[model samples]
Target: MTFENSLAFAQEQDKLDPLAHYRQQFHHPVINGQQVLYFTGNSLGLQPKSARDYINSELDEWAKWGVEGHFHGKNPWVSYHEILTPASAELVGANESEVVCMNSLTTNLHLLFVSFYQPDGKRFKIISEAKMFPSDRYLLETQVRHHGFDPDEAIIEIAPREGEFLLREQDILAAIEEHKDELALVFFGGVNYFTGQLFDMKTLTEAAHKAGALAGFDLAHAAGNVPLHLHDWNVDFAAWCSYKYLNGSAGNVAGIFVHDRHGNNTDIKRFGGWWGHDKERRFLMENNFQPMTGAEGWQISNAPVMGMAILKASLDIFAEAGMPRLRKKSLKLTAYLEYIFNQVVAMFPDYQLQIITPTEPEKRGCQLSIKLIGSDKKFFEALTQAGVIADFREPDVIRLSPTPLYNSFEDVYRFGETLRNLLSQSHH
Candidate 1:
């Protein structure tokens, strides 16, 4: 498809978009009676229009039934998380029993590590990526230290080649091999937040297993944005938040996937809680802990109904528009965005912006991270003032993500026009 730097081209693409109606399903923020052009779905997705009714139903149930709402409601709170399980599994390409929605992402990270990061004897090392989201870095560091090993010695960080912004697949495979002897676990972010690079999880998991290490991923940026074959890929364990691509409420409930082999094993050590107890005997309250089978065994508490309601609304949308279909549109939309960005640079050589994200469609999601050559935040402020919602990373980077579910091709074109106009006027 030949690309053009014109609004007509974008509108034409939108006219042909199969998922174009999905834009109406979300509640984009309004500024001065007009909808802001949103591109932060990589950070927090716009709330689904259905979310209000979904949430209000729960609220009404709480008001009417009191404690009885747990067992009897439009959707029972007792098994609320289950409502999300099947679709969540389909989203990640996992078996139904291998996934569960529960605690926040960091909390689940800790719980998953407890079972998967059991270091013993000489195999006490962990390998991870450098510049991982700060929370993940802290989690790994603290977990390593908790096991009586120095973080510096126990955690090996794989970084990009000296001059590059993305990690090389070969370098990652070699790192697994290099640390094979002492490595107990391999952990990484599924899609890097800063560079928007999608690591090859399937290859990474295979390498980790070959090197005698367990593999895990924090899929905050990858979960709903990209296709995952967790079961087919034989990934050991993974976790992700709903707020970003999934569009659940902000800082909402998170979910996890444990391969059936691990999830079915009741012998694995875990920080158990009552909600994970065998449901049939849970009311009996036995002193002995009998865990449920599969990923349900990881639940620490009863589900958060409000957050799960929002998630349910969002997942229903995904179920209607399947991941495969979404991916099909995503590839074309993102390629078009990249093309327009290139056109901007071509039209104005003085703009001085470089796309730090990988050019391969297979290597990235919707996000394109731009490195501004100048240090000022004025450009970002200008974007905000003009009602374009993107993100700014400290000092140097800006991230623009055009979500396939709600963003149209015209949004991409307008973004280019906005930036080009702002820069041109500022220079004048």
Candidate 2:
């Protein structure tokens, strides 16, 4: 459990791991002709070895089938997004009908909001975390103003207690209690991008429901990294991109989950398109707007076959390993990284690497956000030059994510060793 044991234990655990072979399935990035120790799956996942083949299949069909590809091609383009449903629903713990792979993350967030964020005079407020991803904060702020409310009074931003890196569950619950009367909706990132803390979705959903509000999540960071039960948790809606931890390519399609409870609610008010029109009468060209059954009803454009192909390859890998097994491996891998970090901190009294992520695995995914005291951009740039692929957030945090599918225990060990060397040479 200690740093000294981590290196050996990681190696031994790798030897016994059934999923160890998966590491070889990704194409590791080569920097300056040397392989880098990549720990940034929190931002962009490595390409799966099968990604090329999967994508090529679609290209081949497009070339051979041409105009007929929409209906008659091998893996018909007309319903390509359908192929991803079974795997995506399984990954997110939703019923097959409740999930769909469609547009990008932020776009899906907007669509879901259109349906769920109806504000009235007394209940025209939104509650979200203070330091959300900039896009989310912007979107929510815009939504409040669109509904004719002042952003300052209508937006209930939840900040961490002073000196705390993450929000306590109790505080989040209390915030809901305090603002329950005016709160219209609760939208939060499933895991905080900066702090890498995973909120308790079940508790959050229950609290929001008890307060008579709709609860939704942006799972961009949590999606392939954490196990989610959108259905059981009664989450009204959620969205995520597949590029991170899912091994899909950058800008690949994102997915959405709408609870089965809302499947046929036509009064929800959505911005509709032909794809969302009922498939049976889709070509009838009648102007009457009849929506599809579940989350697929939210689609606005035709399926992007190329993007779905990449996601299919990635989902196939996830289906093989299953999340329960991957999460177990993930915990050990991240704990080893922390063990090494703790040792380095103890060895140098003046130097410090403070972990901003939650201490408990249940409250976080694979990422550990380390605030390097007295460190700067130069320090992070040096790590990149040294073939360590961790990401640097603005100000002082460095994020390292030891992805369970690809990162080894040795990777975490080497990163800590390199950081130790970097600190010892500093003029403290």
Assess each prediction's global lDDT (C-alpha) against the native: 0.92, 0.89
> Worst ten-residue run, lDDT, model 1?
372-381
Give per-model CA RMSD.
Answer: 1.0, 1.3
Give per-candidate clash totals: 0, 0
lDDT per residue (tens digit) for residues 69-161 in model 1: 999988989999999998999999999999999999999999999999999899999989999999999999999999999999998998999
Clashes of 1: 0
Candidate 1: TM-score? 0.98
Those runs of model 1 whose alpha carbons end farther than 4 Å from true positions after fitting are none
**Where's the lowest-lDDT run of ten residues in candidate 2?**
1-10
Q: Each model's TM-score, in the order given?
A: 0.98, 0.97
Question: Residue 310 deviation, candidate 2, in Å?
Answer: 0.7
Give candidate 1's whole-model lDDT: 0.92
lDDT of 2: 0.89
* Candidate 2: residue pairs that collide: none
lDDT for 149 (candidate 2): 84
